[model samples]
Target: MTDASISHLQVLDWGLLIYDDALKLQEALVSERIAELSPDRLILVEHPPVVTIGRSGSLDDLRESEEAINRKGASVFHVDRGGMATFHGPGQLVAYPIVKLQTKDLRLYLQMLLETVAAVLRSYGLASEFRGRNPGVWAGAAKIASVGVACRRWVTYHGIALNVNADLRWFESINPCGDPDGKVTSMERELGQSVDMAEVKDRFTRAFCRIFGYATPPEVRQRPTERPSWLVLSPSCTESIDRMESVLSWLRLSTVCQSARCPNLGECFARGTATFMILGTICTRTCRFCAVDKGKPDAVDGGEPERIAQAVQLLRLKHAVITSVTRDDLPDGGAEHFVRTVEKVRECCPDVSVEVLVPDFRGSLKALQRICDIRPDVFNHNVETVKRLYPIVRPKARYQRSLGILEYAGKHGLIVKSGIMLGLGETEQEILEAITDLRRTGCSFLTLGQYLAPSKEHFPVSRYVSPAEFEEWAQIARSEGFKKVAAGPLVRSSYRAGEMVCSMRQPLKSYQSKG
Candidate 1:
């Protein structure tokens, strides 16, 4: 065959085949293409849990012995790829592109593969970027999809493995691609929803066609309709919501429940408890999932604290939860605003326990120290989703930095609390890992909630978590040595801050004791 590019690509969907079987099929297809008997082919398949070491990999990367590995219902195989050890399983999506190269430039071909996967993720509202030397798409600190390929007779095989909804626990058995520091993340854990494998396959297929310049468009996969159960407000809740709105309007204060477009706003407001956003309504950051207005925010209002205090006093709130939009523009990240608000609330109603849900303060120790020094009843920050989704969902935030904020407050004997949203496409393993990370930060009170899309323009909802799952995680968190665990569909960081403070007055277990 001459070195001419083909006009069309043949994509074969081989569902759940073993590694050896898929390898044989790839060989046959490559031979067919070499002989110019068949068009170039793309093989999409799922392998029943196995670890594959590439040509450049060493045995040191595999942690488990061959016998022990078999006992766990898995196997290790050597492949002809160019990377180190990596695992593949049922939930992960694997694609082998056996296309004849146009110019025999293997490096360029590999880069195109990464771009193709990144493009597919982008369409699903996931933002991934190519690192300088890394051969994968990164969602922040975590590697979501990795590429390892080989070119034989100018045809490519052994493409990319995207962790769509895989259990990340399998990766703990080895240093994936020989990188121990960078963690692995999945679509399910990041998006807080279960993804349909067929749908992901279709999306990848379309992206593959477009990137490789296929003349014909592939079949478009219909997106499954999202059905978030409509929450009904009780009559009492309606009356309370009205009262909460009037008080908030009277004071000209804002609540995150309103600005962030929380689904449980009515219930929280009606219950006379609202997570007040102390700073202006406009946020400095553009988190894709948040509905809070993003722009140059209004200057810090000197009288904002007094109005917030008045709102708390008028509502007779036993606990006042205050949070602010991240103000990267500020010198102290609005730390003074937080401190002054807490002080005003305490002065107005001494009985009101204050919980401050704060930002990372851009990892400034002085800013963190200032918030900690205030001695609020509870110092809270959300690790948000798992570390993997930070770039896609929260582009400007750092996962470890957020943890450090909690650790700093926890070490100071503050009642540290944190929360994460479910159905952001986070795997069960990632959720457990995030909780463990939070627990290490001296966080005892945990809140886990379902993430609802504020609007069509915002990040799409990936999954709706069941009430049972929330209860299950709450029980898991409590059993894991947490002092108080609030896990439910509608649970927010400060929605039940008062009850948590009133019912559980004990200090959190120290980081050392948590072990």
Candidate 2:
């Protein structure tokens, strides 16, 4: 027996085989042969009508009993892999690559497999992704490809199954991969057309070669030699510095926080307060008065919640405001992530208070329910400007929808807050109407501030309201029964958010007691 170290072998086009039946035996046979070969090799195989179970599989997922499975001319066997149970049959291409891991990193291998399958599917005009926390090639929310592999002695055994032109009815007989709630679909299901299996196999081979050949082995890099600059300041100064640091750290994580350009960041940081940006940085829709970059956004980061939690802990923040760029990209409008981040922050620092400035979620009641379920201390949604200017100032968002979101939060007993920017070419009557709309929504907190044009390329500012006008608006907002009203040149959403939320609770409680 040649004991050649697997890493020393430079792999080329290895081997391929197709089996029409006995899939479990085929997998076992291939695995045994690859072990005997004991070097780097790629083996492509196709299985006949069969069902395989992974490590997380349950027998209940199968419709037929073990004896019935054999009587039906198919077989069932539990295998070592990650996902649950799934069906393998003729017309589906299953690749069982027996490649030894030189780097011993399973995550990198899984990611590579996902990208390779997605690339192959994309060639056929199919969009796919390995959505975070989901282990497969997904076309939208349906699984097009399933992956389950096991590594023994750092050598992989089981591999992936791409549903090219497979009969999907078999999936109905069982909870495919034991995911009772998940829908099992194929390329045919998505395109409403049959796919050519032979052509798909060819594409898969080419894609595999391209991805594996060029794939760089995972590596661990040394930490940065230089330490980050640490700023020391007085108790007041420390708060401001910490707040800025939290926001900066959040931005570095590639999530969205509207670069608020609030003049009060310095002061808030001095008080050790920060406004956390959740979801992602890009907005699905553009608003005229805001400085947040608007465009087609990338996918929401699943790790954002944990990072926000870590930021709260790192800053030792007593109060944090979590806000996000509008994410019409998601069905939930990123409300789930917002709730998750809030929950995580509360878990990390139970004493700290959390405020969520959420989007309208396209008036999704389910989305609102998901957020209300979290029971954040405050729920804020900005109207941006008056209803008359809504079309031009906040075109994609409806004025009524914003009101509804705040109303829903209030109805659920959350402290509801909304803000409007002045100097958007609105009349005093329009401003009053907007305030009335907000009050009708049961919003107890109001913030009115001058709208400063972020850039010359952006929407031009119509006018900057004078300090006297802001004061008058504040008075009007108070008269409208807003428990806490802040109107000024520099007030932005989440600016001194803790102070606002803290101040409103007393008056609201008192009002409720009187009633």
Candidate 3:
């Protein structure tokens, strides 16, 4: 049951996603599959109640008015698939396979999809068959699964939806598959019992792999064992490194450069710059992609902000960058601590411009406003990755919440900035979308860097993006209307805080070191 050409398949289980967001992910992956940049991938997810009208569908297919449907807390969309009207909601297993078709015969692909669903149903001791005219799997006279797909350049997307334990009442709103007399049912109804969705997903994955001639897919692609030549860092001056370390130790200060194991640590330290991580070293949230310690963080130190200011003074830093571990344990998310730190830095080094790469402050507008009152040179927050990867990459954070923070700061006349890491299995289209989103929020500065896995225990790096590719991204970001773009293998949120601000020739230029 294997084709020599089909060596591997990747399965991405997105727990729960909005209908539109999942479509964007499919569109992004379709392009990658067409370009042969990525392997075949299956996106598994469940959507909140949504009725999607395909190319052949019309408003007539919907039994309820669009307004009536809205009142029921369901969404409606016109999609580009081959079917008519289809309803997707919780308790339904939706699978979108982004695969490079070996042949252009779409009928064969569609039939395979039906076969996969039928086989999975059979595993539950339910017999299903393909009914007349319509493209779907049926149990007796009732539909158990709906099949529809769209293809681009011989790459396929918009796959099948199987009714495992879905509530059949939602189907009453639409003439399922545009059929006037279609009957829809779920495995729970057919078997006269409830079915475990997790078990159904497992069976479907196995059935899909076996029928499609693919070997068992790995949960995640294995990371490359060796580092690329470009990632090889140049040697730094030991005297400069020792001097900065001595200063940081004397002040009892912490820097993300050391805690996050930033690749630019040696280079930035040699240049007398560091992104000070305040509050405490331990983070309350356990983001899979970060290396910072995660635990119940200690009480905030009242004297820590003064030490950070003293470190800025001793180092003669022109642009002092401040960041902190996510302190969700605090009521204001340590917003007051940020205010105190900024005030102390201003008192100690009036000439030095301040930049705070802060957290989302747990989406508290009042908390963010506290920092905006002080008005640092830059208000930076990392969206970190695409919305599609939120559940797996940084499960504790919300994408819209992060964006809201940036948008709120921008509205208050702050020079907003944000960063994102690459090679976490994200497609180029996704990155471009992120850049556009940032610009819309009036984020003037952007940092695009390669994500390095801190350890095997952390999220694995999907691939090592080449330097040329990174430069190309930088140009694309600038073209998106960003005022300043810092993109490279080693670029970070505060990689070159002073230089980026000075190059802009803004008011912060006065703070640049003359030497």
Candidate 4:
């Protein structure tokens, strides 16, 4: 039931205090609220690295001993909350609702806490849900927030802890919330940047007040009247997508743009451009974030190159982007297939610029050299994300190895291009370092796009990066010497590829003429 009878809540933001101190404050507030000495108050605090175990929790839940945790600059506490072990540290926003429980039912109170945080996360476009096993907010396989509460004669304290940007390594030192297999992720990790804790606190206070019937939500934005400018497809694009699907299905050829569930699929196909996944639809590598089907793929289609080239000619396209699922099982990692496709496209649509976005070929010099020898108009590869995130994001793909492929292509006089998705939990410094690494490999063009979480099953989108942040990164990339830059929330590797080739037309023509 809505607490529409409640009028207001006093919110206290206590920044970066020790866990014990906050616990003491919660105790005091709980007493005051029960005595009617204070209003229904909410306390927001960022705790120093500490792990708190609930009433029934055991010391065995702590992966590290008290002495070890103390030495590492964190502390452990036995608390009166209702969950097992949970870690709180810098970058995480912890909320303690020192409110008189409007309902005598404990279940409803806990669900309210979960809803309050879930509502706040949803406002930022992050999907937070509670699976039956975990009585908290989860996004995909990662737990975004935990709810634990206590009641002293129906006055509640110790409300919720939602990770805004916490360091996740600390969660590893304990069987957090009694699940050793459960993974902990933060808002920063999910959204791809460090959000202002103060701002998040304000948003949370507003959201909590609204959920508990204390206040109405203020206007932040209106329902969009138009499509997101970047995602706007031509009026005819839908018909084109239908036509494109029919052709692909008939030929049994695959496109990553389709299989990956890229948001730009309709727009790209409608525009008669596609990033063809030539080898097969099934990807060998199971990236946490990719939506591509993962399993054993079918045998390579020998006639794929001819069929793709014919499709290009039939569409009368000016550019064709060919990418592939990583085929680690192959001897040459599908390098020869790339050669066949490029040659076929050039022979059929000679003027159509062929951009091959290839895998690292298992870091083989021979494979890189083989594709470089064919001399496609533009050679593109994607680093996908910054190095630190590779372990979690692209487990099988090495950051350095991918760069080597792009570097080799550039050295051989091909106009090299590489790109990454922003907000993969990469810091500004890490992103700049990644950009510098790409530039060092002689990559001249870059495509920096927001990483969309293809579905709830995939890695949850950490944050909905604003258009302005994308622009800022684009400027930094150009300043760092990227010749052509495409940075935006809706940009994907093959999205607006025709424009990329068009921008480099003068340089490409001059280079080809010299050759």
Question: For each candidate, what is the lDDT?
Answer: 0.80, 0.70, 0.85, 0.79
Q: Cα deviation in Å at residue 81, candidate 3?
A: 35
Task: Decide which is better by TM-score, 2 or 4.
Answer: 4
The sequence of per-residue lDDT tens digits that candidate 1 reaches over residues 234-280 is 34456777888898888888888777766666766655567999779
For candidate 3, the C-alpha RMSD (Å) to the true structure equals 15.6
Q: Which residue ranges in model 3 land beyond 4 Å of their true spot?
A: 1-210, 213-223, 504-515
- Indicate the worst ten consecutive residues by lDDT in candidate 3: 506-515
> Whose TM-score is greatest here?
3
User: Best candidate per lDDT, number?
Assistant: 3
Ranking by TM-score: 3, 1, 4, 2
Q: Candidate 2 lDDT, tens digit per residue, 82-150?
A: 788888776577766666666678998888877878988888788887766658888887888889888
Each candidate's TM vs. the true structure?
0.58, 0.51, 0.60, 0.58
Ranking by lDDT: 3, 1, 4, 2
On a 0 to 1 TM-score scale, where does candidate 3 land against the true structure? 0.60
Clashing residue pairs in candidate 2 (N, C-alpha, C atoms within 3 angstroms): 85-177, 239-269, 239-272, 240-269, 240-270, 256-280, 256-281
Candidate 2 Cα misplacement greater than 4 A, ranges: 1-239, 254-258, 503-515
lDDT at 393 for candidate 4? 71
